[model samples]
Target chain A: MAALDVAPAARRGRPGYDQNSMLEVIVEVFVDRGYDASSLDTIAKRLGLSKSAVYHHFTSKAEMLEIALERVLGELERVFDDAEALDLPAVERIRRIISEAVLVACARQQYLVLLLRLHGNSDVELNAMARRRELTARLSRIFEAARAEGGARDDIDPALAARLTFGLVNSLVEWYRPDGPDEPAALADTVLAFVRSGMLAADGRGPR
Target chain B: MAALDVAPAARRGRPGYDQNSMLEVIVEVFVDRGYDASSLDTIAKRLGLSKSAVYHHFTSKAEMLEIALERVLGELERVFDDAEALDLPAVERIRRIISEAVLVACARQQYLVLLLRLHGNSDVELNAMARRRELTARLSRIFEAARAEGGARDDIDPALAARLTFGLVNSLVEWYRPDGPDEPAALADTVLAFVRSGMLAADGRGPR
Candidate 1:
């Protein structure tokens, strides 16, 4: 749920560049320099175009941010929908979801990074956060169901457990580099194992 | 291992403000506005002062960042030292360390937020990361030792366990508010229970 502004009648479709390509370039610049510091002029220059060329496609910086975020949110929401539909056991559904999420993060890494790092500066960001909260609520319900079915531990508070799971997943933005030594599938396994079994010994035989 | 720039030469004596109070103000700004967006002028303005007044206390933004990071790191290192000296059983020590970490997070929340939100933008930030790496390594060793002593699971990877523990603790910055509903002790207990027992049912079930 991102806000998109319509360009002025004079500027709409008057771009020297393709609107879609220009949006892609803007997304790249936003990820590179952060949303606040990245300027339209810098983005235009990087694309070998003029500032007017950039303005023809998007009305302002906020418009670009919303478009980029919309792309990410659409993809993420799709994955969650797929996970929700899987006709498997809860653990299996979760595993499949985790694997798919890793692939999504790797494939759409920049957009996902931007989505995860939103600092809530503007009304658009506030709107995005509300969408995020709604999604979080849905995920939390899934976790609750899984726990109710005895897939997750009843010992841990479901709300806290849900938050911890999401946190572990989100922290991937901080360290999971696509070019790093680990392959995406392998990285997913490592992450999955950590989330499932934790760091302690399986036999509960680790040192104090 | 944060670099401490000496207070500016002109600020050696004057008295109305000094390095510590200035740091307090800086931390507040950092927590309020994401670090990259906060300027020296903003910090000064928040203090009802001028740019010179801010500069008098610190040479640049990096200096403020270093001091803010050091406040948290210094406390972290001390906690590790204290945990190491305790003669308690390994499981108890682990619980104590986790509890202490949550308390540290609650008390020095801003500095801890700064520590947790590093984006790897500079050498200083990278160095801070290196420090975190070393701390994680040390904690991993402790967990490994505890595992060896048969207090934890033998099948779990020590490194992943440590990261999960870290993930749980670090996630506190993202959501936990000191003035929030949960009590610190209660939150710590929830975390400890989850880490020990895990998200699975007592029957060791997988998601469904």
Candidate 2:
């Protein structure tokens, strides 16, 4: 369960998977063991490479961690950029943003775990936290706009709503297994429907 | 901050915070550095006790983790017991349960982080997870009873709704700070009110 050992025949056809691929494997190891406890030598052993070979691409373990985090942040920044460019209705934009979030979490499972566990005490975490806060503020503004447009209920506090919204999205990393049970799209859809319609069906709205 | 430094002066007057107090400090450190990375010697040094002295109460670090998790489980069980004994309506019981959750999260912040971070790989985590699942099932039963009494939306999937309900409750561990701006009761009220009435004022339901 540590690392998948690849055969020599499989390595010949694989071209794109190089330093980045090795780094991703190291990130998974970091997520398993506490980052401070995980060693570069262990990571190198997992990749069937010498420690110097691993260090050839990256200077140190900290550099590997930085590169992995940057990859995740870069993907999220791109998602935010795409969400910002869309001129669709506010609720639709939110739905798309959440869906994209699920996709990212599913695709980059270890990186997402690393991102969530950050305490902001380190320089890397602090920088990532700032970016995350900015992204959250952006989402908060969108929620407010949606409320203003009567796309969502006006009674809900936009800030609180945004927190709950992210909570729902973030919970995916805990229980969502890409290899098990439901497909990612279905899980995302279930979450989207719950968010939009509440837990009640149209007929279940009661006397109101 | 890693762990609190226990001093000689503080020990003389207040009858000294016991092993339980020291365990609380160690829990905070574990939450920060993670379980495997945190050492008993650091906990001992933080509390101004020798490592041998710290080892007297708990045989191993993992036992300390078990007790911390058990303490949280104990609180949840107590809250549920009180909620069950209350002869109020089902909706009122649910409200009380949610409010209790907020209080518990605020009071036991470090323990809550440990509970949330449990990976279910260890026996302690697996046991705690089983208790959690049972608690969720119990809450779902109350939700069913409430719906049967014609208060809740009948078309809702009780399990999914239960997940969302607890999702809102458990999420406080991620961000709610006791030292932060909002009061626990007020924040719980806001969440409960919004959840019950939703964003529409016309729905007209108030917190029970």
Which candidate wins on DockQ?
Answer: 1
- Model 2, A79-198: lDDT tens per residue? 778887989887778878878876776677678777777765568777877877777787788888888777667756787777777776676676556677657677677666556544
Encode model 2's per-residue lDDT on B23-118: one tens digit a residue. Answer: 878998888767766777777777677788778778888799899999998998899999999998877788788889878877887898888776
Q: For candidate 1, lDDT tens digit of each residue in A10-82?
A: 4434345677777777777877666766777889788776788667778888888888878777877787899
Candidate 1 runs further than 4 Å off: A1-33, A37-59, A86-96, A202-208, B1-22, B50-52, B84-96, B143-158, B204-208
Each prediction's TM-score versus the true structure: 0.76, 0.77
Worst 10 residues of 2 chain B by lDDT: B199-208
CAPRI level of candidate 1:
acceptable
Q: Least accurate stretch of 10 residues (summed lDDT) in model 2 chain A?
A: A1-10
Worst 10 residues of 1 chain A by lDDT: A199-208
Per-prediction CA RMSD (Å): 8.3, 6.5
